[model samples]
Target: MPQKKLPRLRGMDNVREDEELEQFGDSASLFVRDAININFTSAGRAELRQEMKLATDQALRCLWQSPLHKDCFAALGSYWCKVDAETWQIEQLIECGPGDVFHIVLNNMICMACDEGLFVYDGSQAKRLTIDTPAKPNATDAGDGSLPASDYSLAISWVANGLESALSEIDQVSLSKNSSINLQFPMCLDPNVSHVRVYMTEPGGGELQQAIELNIATRSVMIANLPELGRAAQFQYLSPMKTGNFLREWRGRLWAVRSNVLYFSEAMSYHLTDERYNFIQFPQRIRFIEPVDGGIWVGLADHVAFLRGQDVRSMSIERKASRAPMYGSSTLLHSDMIKELSQGGTWCAVWLAENGFVSGTAEGQLVELQYKSIKGISAESCQLVGFADRLVSVVN
Candidate 1:
């Protein structure tokens, strides 16, 4: 057979395959590479001329920036190393055991949840906050009324006909104070009592009434815009249900979640108790919860919910009746996969979805970023971290 003359290829467009034409379609500034490292410029452009390489061969599991130490922490394999922000040098901090998860940072303390226990690191030392075995409280003696009270105590007494009755003990108490008071209790307290009563007392006349306006929890109580009660304010220790798996501080309150239940402590309180905190149940397991804008964003197995209210006591499952469902059957990978970044002046939460990636705003807006380049990549193999002006995603 005679050879037929073929047209000379002039450019990529002339020789492009059907898939390449569909993916790159008429775009001049688009580029794709199997492995390419690029730097983001101050002018908001990706400078692809320079390439970089990883210092280690281990897979990167998680990445976090510590404002206290001015460095970045990277969890690779079973080891956590600190990357110096100025020199970009990596220093191994500790070798974590299997199933160890780094939770959050509060008060310059790094919190981690592991199979062993809850650990907190204060820059230099790591200590586990032990959840002691709950002790059983003995029945009150009928005659003597002598019970060794906890390090904290709360009592109430009634006065009638100018006669004062003996004070009766209560589990929880809320008091009004003009100044900020720190309520401290033993880390290990009996977990039997569930509810505590708070009383607002008039300092001058010794008049007391049940405090309905004050926010009190098992670990702390916050009283605002009220006069000092001197020595009249008191509280007794009480045990609440077991703590949840995930903990985060949001809107002046501590939020904990386990399975499908979400619990929030009282305003400005860190104590997690049934009486001091309220819980909302969701249809699916809550995978992530984080503070966004001025409220909270909860990521469930199949949906996302936003919570913003003045009082945590009033938050219920009914408030989440309008949750936005995820695309198809996609779900979040892990709680730590969610990252909140500032886009323009508003805050946006980005997470790794089972399909690709998704972003949501505090205003109940969700956008799925299923770019053609990342469409079919396994979600578990993708890790995302937000820097000052850019989002870096690594695929293994």
Candidate 2:
């Protein structure tokens, strides 16, 4: 035709954008965004523990309390300060309403809870903030059995600096006897987090639920009872359940263990189906459930059992006869279960037959008891308090 001009070549004629993209595939793109390479070996376990130790040390608050000191502290409900773990020296034993506490979060804000309201403690004074309570139509005793027409007032003084500008309401849920509050504020599920759950034990001696779901993004409140509410959305017990209790959540599913149990909601296929929970009764009374690598290690007075999925197989001791009997028919003793360590340290108590009892710490320290000697231990210095080996206090 008209001297078809040789196809005009662009300046960078050889450059192929699609070819470069194909060569740098998904793996390369993913590596640039988020990459995790795990090396699994014996070294990994020790490395994990070290990382965990560093994390805990940076996050936890360490305090020391003697028996007499604790009794006086509880009696007064006062707020006091103790030495940092690094310093190992106590300081600032101030007096408050015997219920005041210094809560350290993110290694910055130290908060104090007072009757007036939740207050921010700036290592010195308590600054109170106005908090909103649920609308009580009849003002029926305001949640904690107090005859007061209003709900329990919480005063917090220290709000993490930048967070203070955003702090809307901070409520302090009281702990029942032998119970604790496991609070997850700015929860893990929602990055722009808002809601706070109040999990508490029922005054009727079971479990109770009160959800304060406020969408920080939207600033709205939603409350639902656990039994009636589906478990698909985020849900946690107001109080930690006993070693053996069944729970049905919003998403249907079934999960059980001697220590904790759950029934999942049908909406969540990833979870167990919700239905009537069944408890497995052992021929002998179960004392404790300790989780190991792949299964649960069950403790019994006479022998130990390893449970994998559903099959329960007993682990025979090389010296079974040498182990002392911990429980008798219809009677259980305090020594039957393992002793829990205080100050977030790992320690377990085990019966050693003629050896009487042995307590070992994560650090490999051993406390042994015999008929004549209670060696390698100072009971007075122990920060652990428990009944029948059920941990009660982890005093620092």
Candidate 3:
């Protein structure tokens, strides 16, 4: 005896019989499964595959119809859809609403809004919206209650894109896994705030890392550590001068140089392993640091140096020369005043400053950089993450 097949739904009693969809005429019958696996005969196997296909198609339609999904679909072209665990069988396609997608985890899924505004949403409800301004808000505008009254933004990272590709199963965006929710910001120029904050939390909204705060009144400098939430972190007070400067993490060290005073903490550990109460005592203000020859590259006013283990030495003795590419004699006047540096490719990248930008390679080769004309806009605040192919930055 042949196995029985599931019945197909009719499309308003089709007058043309040939136009009707076949439930079993083509390949096989279908069955749907949630998570559990079921053993079935060859006939059942065919049905399961068909059922999976139908489920996936229906889910995609729901995702596509969503207003939230359509708004910035291009920037989020990397976005993918999956069946909602609780509403898998719901026939109506999922529409983008308050709760369609909210969180983005590395290599997991990323939820983004179409417009350049703040979107507040609960799991299923959107609470409020605020549009972003073109220019940095002035001090007077900062006092106005235009921005959301959220303190967490001070220590957060503003990722414009590439967020959806960062999530992973170890930290997925489901209800059960150790998931975390981060509000995304494209730029950080709010007059009210000094700097953005970055924190890591657990599925239940518990903090996993402590908060890192940057100073907005200063240059583009930041500590590269995601605070360890819940842990009581202690720091040996090495009174770093409050020169209104910034701290940066490189090669696993919290590095801060104030008026020639070089202060360094162990990488990730944040422990004051070594401190030269005065950095100017060594040479010039350590301009920048990089990774070279399996060691750390330290840039000074006129030389490129290296540090490995505990030994620091100058690799190039060309003092008074800029470590970065120079377009003219004036760009080198402030070799220590590097505004921005980004990896361009496996071998090249561009730099930025108030005057203009330059380019460089991993092998210490540098060149003045230029951007191919895009509309009437010029690239600024540009940073290269992977190689030269994927440039992530915004233009003024």
User: Of the candidates shown, which would achieve the greatest lDDT relative to the real structure?
Assistant: 1
The Cα RMSD in angstroms, rounded to one decimal, for candidate 3 relative to the true structure is: 26.2
TM-scores for all candidates: the values are 0.52, 0.24, 0.25
RMSD of 1: 12.2
| Best first by lDDT, ranked | 1, 3, 2
TM-score of candidate 3 to 2 decimals: 0.25
Worst 10 residues of 3 by lDDT: 161-170
Which digits, one per residue and each the tens of the lDDT, describe model 3 over residues 1-396? 999556533212122244333446665333332213233343334223223334333423213222333221111222323334344533221233332232221112223232222222323433222212222211111232222222221223321221101111112122222222332333445333444333334323533343443343443323222244543222222321221122334454444444444555443433233344423234665544443333444445544444443323333322323333111111111222233444432423233422234443444555443322111223322222221222323333
Better lDDT candidate (2, 3): 3
Q: Write the per-residue lDDT of candidate 1 for residues 68-181, one digit (tens) a residue.
A: 665566655666656565665667655655542545666577765444444556676554432232222211212222222222223433222222222344323222322332
Model 1, residue pairs in steric clash: 153-235, 154-235, 172-196, 172-197, 173-197, 173-198, 174-198, 191-239
Q: Tens-digit lDDT track for model 2 on 216-302? A: 433222222222321222222111111121111111222223322311222322111223322334555544333322333343545
lDDT of candidate 3 at residue 143, scale 0 to 100: 32
